[model samples]
Target: MGAVATLVAGLGIATATSANAAAGCRVTYANGGQWPGGFTANVTVTNLGDRIDGWRLGWTFASGQAVSQAWNATVTASGTQVTAANVGHNAVLATNGSASFGFNGTWTGSNPAPAAFTLNGVACTGSVGQPSQSPSAPGPGPSASSSPSTPPTTPPPAGDAMAAVAAMQPGWNLGNSLDATGADETSWGNPRITEALLDGIKAQGFKSIRIPVTWGQHQAGAPDYTIDAAYLARVKEVVGWALDDGFYVMVNIHHDSWQWINTMPADRTNVLARYNATWTQLAAAFRDSPAKLVLESVNEPQFTGSSGDAQNATLLNELNTSFRTIVRNSGGGNVTRLLVLPTLHTSADQARLDELTATFTAMNDPNLIATVHYYGYWPFSVNIAGGYRFDATAQKDLTDMFDRISTTFVARGIPVIIGEYGLLGFDRHTGTIEQGEKLKFFELFGAQARANNITTMLWDNGQHFGRTSLQWSDPELIAQIRSSWTTRSGTAASDLVFSARSAAITSKTMTLNLNGTTFTGLRQGSTELVRGTDYTISGDQLTLSAALLTRLSGSRAYGVNATLHVHFSTGVPWRLNLITHDTPVLSAATGTTSAFTIPTTFRGDQLATMEATYADGSNAGPQNWTPFKEFDYTFAPDYTGNVITLKPEFFADVTDGSRVTLKFHFWSGAVVTYYVTKSGTTVTGTLA
Candidate 1:
């Protein structure tokens, strides 16, 4: 929704009169703000006669206005009458007390405030009047008896600000839950959070949790811009749970950065009011809470209508400054509460870091913390533009970023936090980044983060953690990540020890990526393999003897037959899978653009990466910049399904009637060629 240009106030007040009325109620309906086709309305109901429990405010819209979303109340519209019921935390209305709720609605020609209102079906009689002058001011909450009786005790202050933030390392994000935009927190498909889930994360060695929340959907309109008490209470509940469980928690205005905050330059007054109002409420709510809770100013703050970097930086500075002042002046523990400030989009670019450094200089607050997000090298992060491997370029990106942030913040006594760190490719699927390559990225990223003295939080978004099961999808991947926090982990150029079942087995060699750790030895289960007999290490290469491979592959299975553990002097041991496979065979098939599956006989081979190109040798997949399309985005191998699924995302990018060639790269050093053609809605595949 854009900034409202026009405002209409005091159309009419609804008066309800009945003997059965629990108490008399007066409603002030006003069009707080409006744009072209939509407007926001603020509704305040004051109980006049007596106190009422579980109140329901009802009104009839005379101008055919339809409510789309509401906060602080459960609003439902039937024909012209709209009903707003109290939520759990705000269910009681005391005598002469008031409860306020707001909603965004649509109007065609004119928006006139409703004429009459009723409380619990009894008519409320009140004269039409202008809305409150200060609508942004939060209404009177539940009576003192119904609210928390005492403020929480403040936690003792840590000696140093840098030390305080540094203690909050290895954080995990509760992503795609509260940050999801829709009816409620779980609108994004992730399950509602639970204490057990937090316990699972703690068990994994995480010290903190970053809760990203989008408060816009649950907030009322200007001028009061009040947040729903129920929503606020829920956020508080989750934060309190994490804190009580002994995990440092960080909360921030997520997604709203791009939603409404980005329009600050275009609508400074409205945007600033809401921004200030959000922090005011949050600071007030968490004021008495312990210092274990950190308040981040904003998540990936960015301005849409700004002139350039300078203007964007200035706008962001304004937000951060406002956020700090609000929290600090809000009283309670907020006076000394640690605040996190971010660069533009929370980026670690040199210019952005320097800009933030200037802000720190101006603020000169020892309690302040610098924060940024890292998603690895852009290309490798998303497996796009030919960045198919976690190679030199990708590793350099991570180091350069960590080096800059360390020098700018950590080295200067200002603690830093990588608020979110993960591979962008994980969004599509974890498999988007090849497994071995993905592991390498996380291993190096954890070590680098530790070396830089920066707290790192993994952005899970339901991919890393199995929310329902309270387990990780990939145990080895998490194991590697957890190991990197304290020490380096030994990996390899590859994790697979492939042997062709069609031919006699031979000695296989793998270049050990020691990652600064010395290789100890190789083992199977609890038995250590004898050196030279089982494997021999010469320089960086570790070669497995043919005799051992033949013994491991007793029946020449098409898949993994045995597993070998390669230990190192320090960190977690690397696991190598002994697989016996010849090659994969793809059979021709015909399907539609929406769904296309090519039957395949793996014959023991495992798919690694895929390359897609047009007949003219041009890239032919969603990631057009790379002939080697992302692993899972364009094509995925389903060994159990006995087929290769060419995803719709891949077909969506191909030209109609174009013959695209696909090369499936397998772990056994085999690449099979195939061709696919998309003709309108129909698609056909053929063996090449």
Candidate 2:
């Protein structure tokens, strides 16, 4: 017992009038396992009262201890107060029934057992139990009681691979800094990863860490490709930080772009040899390590020039096959160790993924997992700008992508990992979406991924979450991500259903009887509306405010078409189409040919009639005012509406203070005539 302690507290009887006596609860706290810097504890709560509806076990750590991962309960910590709440299924407890929940925690220099525990706001009355030996304790490692033995050579149980994949909680990627362009890790802007940083990540509720290391630049020689001894040692040291704290660790070869592993047939043999050598050494080093440590075959392997070619996909399969063969043949723990394989470019494209599934299924290795990187619909996930929102389209894309993986792989007993998934950053500059949208994305992603048996690893290039400070740059984002993982209950795709209905409104007040019980966020089209500002809700009855109702009437008068989007607090975005009898409208404007400026409010109103009168007083017919010749247009349906362009020829007709009168009919049945005056290439217009 390196830092384990067993402090027994005497049982205290509660008076009849006390809350404890009314509840009739008892709890037993015991240390399950302990290592040098961390330990696992299990708390069993017994309900002796009349039927308990729900349960929450609370305790204060005597030492400076923090919980990392917990199961059978949703655990949260604030300072010294730790609360573990029952999940949906575990909430109900009959008299004399008990439920057990366990957590892995990190402690500083000393580890002390909590003296008291409370269940459901009632003090538990029972003698605290002594620390007992854990039957599921990890094999001998850094601070184990027993000495290390030879690594197990046999494979794990048949379904162990899927089990391990499901066991992996939300993961973080130590990116860019490790997979930098050069051999120096600090060159990528992050400080050297410290044990404190790893502990901080665990304390923040992350159950796994994916360390992406580029070993190609650190290797020497040709055929042998001998990995540098110092580099290997450094990787091992960082990996130990996670392993010592009982975190599921995944290490992989990243950014080794020099090797045309899938292309260049001349170097294919040597590439295979180098891959074999790399895994051989890695498997040997961590052979005796616990099963929590996983080895990924490669990261996003692609052909030199062609990323998504069918031929390259076949080659990627070959490389993955070689990886599995080499690792399994390396003996030691490699025989049973879980290995991650990536699709071509690690793409979420269905065809490439299908090819990977066929190839991997042929390998027939139960310890193998298929991985793909998810940054679906780049504009929403990355490169986010102003007016960005997690709208219906973004929601569908994410849900559909995960559904494909679930049906294609997980349903067939093959597990998948979203190796990397996250918005670019959490700041206003990089992440322009509102905090609500970000939270919605995380919640939907986590809920869907968990339900599909897919693990999501967030990609952080050290900008969003600080590594040195041991604190999150965006605490709200971190909290949202953690909430998704902890609040997840059901494991069915149907749990996240999306539906749309046509709502009828006869008065200023409207009631929306929702299918779901709770509401998370509300939106009208792409514009997210504030709860109190736009509407009010009690149970399922949602009432629109009188002011908002007036605005809706005004929008209807202006022929605006919008939908009311509702998302349940649990998870699921449904739409209510607020159909009105108003016709749609389109608006347009012209800009100077030199630099066109489309009004932000322009709606790309289609041109019904067009005629331009030039400076000479000669009229150009409708044929001469063709839409393309007059201006170019960019339309983002359901997004930013549309943009209009002013053509160069049109600008020339109004040059040198010349005035050109143009009359146009819009699709909305509105007509307007405007005179444009130009000075050089710049043009100005006024309604005539």
Candidate 3:
């Protein structure tokens, strides 16, 4: 909160005020182009603010002259010279791009650099003097060397590109006890299952998403434990439907500390007034959520009042001083919340307690964070709840105990995140890594937690199998939970394309980047110009992300094909309700492209299930069109290793000239390549 000064005409320009980028941000400034005293000044950073992870550009120099030395990043000075670090490399630089760092100081009288200058507090724009001498430049242009230029610049560490995209997300168990009994959509944490574990995790690309939630079997301690208003308004309507279906949810207190840690009362004002009335009723119920509503406070906490090693480091300095007095208590839930804290037995690794380990200092608040968990060597990790058989020396002793839980929290400076490691893939799903080595160990630990920025989740409950409370939508397990979810918006080392002219459906583009940056999508339905909201191509399949066009604007409060949901891929049933809507409004409801066809005397598979009737209602109910349950039986001219690939959902490249009758959802023994090409009654095929 430090910007509000502007004088301009004489060139006073200096601003940096971010109470969260006012709304959106990519903010920059720090003298890589010059900011302080010698004053050549030119710094700007904006885009999706209000959620910063790294920025600290302070001001003031009546002359204390400190910061004389700095490096690729970290630099500090006493009373009045600030530069706070981390913004390079891990640049999500708010939506698109632009980064800056400053240097070159020394002022004698009138101008030394402050009328207002901020970077993480948001406030920038000052110009009171400097730059009118350019009009007199007629003769010899080589005379402009002003004696001040340090161009090399590199100052990073302000939440290091959203702490490397919140370290590469994946933390499950939301609205807990397996999403209060998963019916589907993984009961909101998302998990309808079957896009083959989400195209084997979007074909091996995973990014982030960690569900976890129990909130004491649905809060509502009625009146005071104060958690149950229809179970905290259905946990803020499923954390605003998983941050509007783009993932990154977190919401913990898992067992609700049995009522937020043993029912208050251990001094400190009745546990800081019941943890500030449970985070002021859960941070005013998700203060305009967007960076994926993450509020985890009390998932593991059970070590009991200090003992031994400096009272186990004074019980983690009284749980980091009750997590910075419940996140700098301004009212509750947390005023600019971003707290995660977990150590002691919840062990996110404070080096297994030897003493002095404690952290929480607020005031310098950038929305504090700290959480760490991993089952690592739990019987070849992915034993999926005592389902047994890790064999191979227990998968190399849980991969060297997950490389010692990733070399013990990637050597502090915190940001390791692994909320729940598949907790046990039940022998990677029914043993022998389900014939695929625990699903290629969740696709090589989601590219080793997006290359060690680490953020994981996969405790799965879609029915840990027939009895732990039933939830396993099947279909190769929600296509491996939508293939490790990291839907490319930025950094996963880049690779989420689609713009080959963006293909049809109305020129549906796609680019959702992160290293080179781009990401800004925003389209949902209706049809006007019908352009695909920033992205969603169909062919090679892409989403580019507008968080699914803000969940397709709630799909259908009315029409647009009346969508309750219809995302064919993000992997498995992340969502899908679109009954129909390209155009057609007859009291709405009924679509997957309803055209109507049936004459081939139907060949098996229960005559292709046929039932759909529409509003008149049929296909039994819960939406129709069934068939898919593992019907991909190879050989349709079979031989991917030799130019024979046909996957139009299964089959369709026909030139049938009326003499090409075929049907098979399961026929195998490879070799079903067909290649006819007539015209008369519509016929085309090419599988040789």
Q: What is candidate 3's lDDT per residue for 379-489, written digit by digit as tens?
A: 345322222233446455445544554555444444546566563434223332222234434544554565555566665444332222222334333333333343211
lDDT of 3: 0.37
Clashes of each: 11, 1, 113
lDDT of 3 at 44: 41
Q: Estimate the TM-score of every prediction.
A: 0.76, 0.58, 0.24
Question: lDDT of each structure?
Answer: 0.79, 0.60, 0.37
Stretches of model 2 off by over 4 angstroms after superposition: 1-159, 257-266, 306-308, 383-387, 424-429, 488-515, 519-535, 538-688
Q: Where's the lowest-lDDT run of ten residues in candidate 2?
A: 490-499
Question: Which of the numbered candidates is closest to the native, going by highest lDDT?
Answer: 1
Between prediction 2 and prediction 3, the one with superior lDDT is 2
List, residue by residue over 387-473, the lDDT tens digit for candidate 2: 145666888989888988888889888888889988653322333333445666777787687667788899888866677765556
TM-score of 2: 0.58
Give the deviation of candidate 3 from the true structure as CA RMSD. 24.5
Error of 2 at 648 (Å): 23
**lDDT, candidate 1, 1-688, per-residue tens:** 0011111222221221222433466876755455445555666787776445556677888888877545456566657767776654345666676665555566777888887887765567853222221111012233222222332222225537776766677789999998998888778898899987876665554668999999998999988789999999999999988886667899999999999999999999899999999999999999999988899999999888689998998899999999999999999889988899999999999999999999999999989999999999987987666676788999999999999999999888999999999988788877777677888898999889878888988999999888877666775677567667666778998777788888999999989889898988897754689998999999789999999999989999789899787887766567788988888899999999889999999988877778889888988877687788776777788889999998899999999999999888877779999999999999999989
Decide which is better by lDDT, 1 or 3: 1
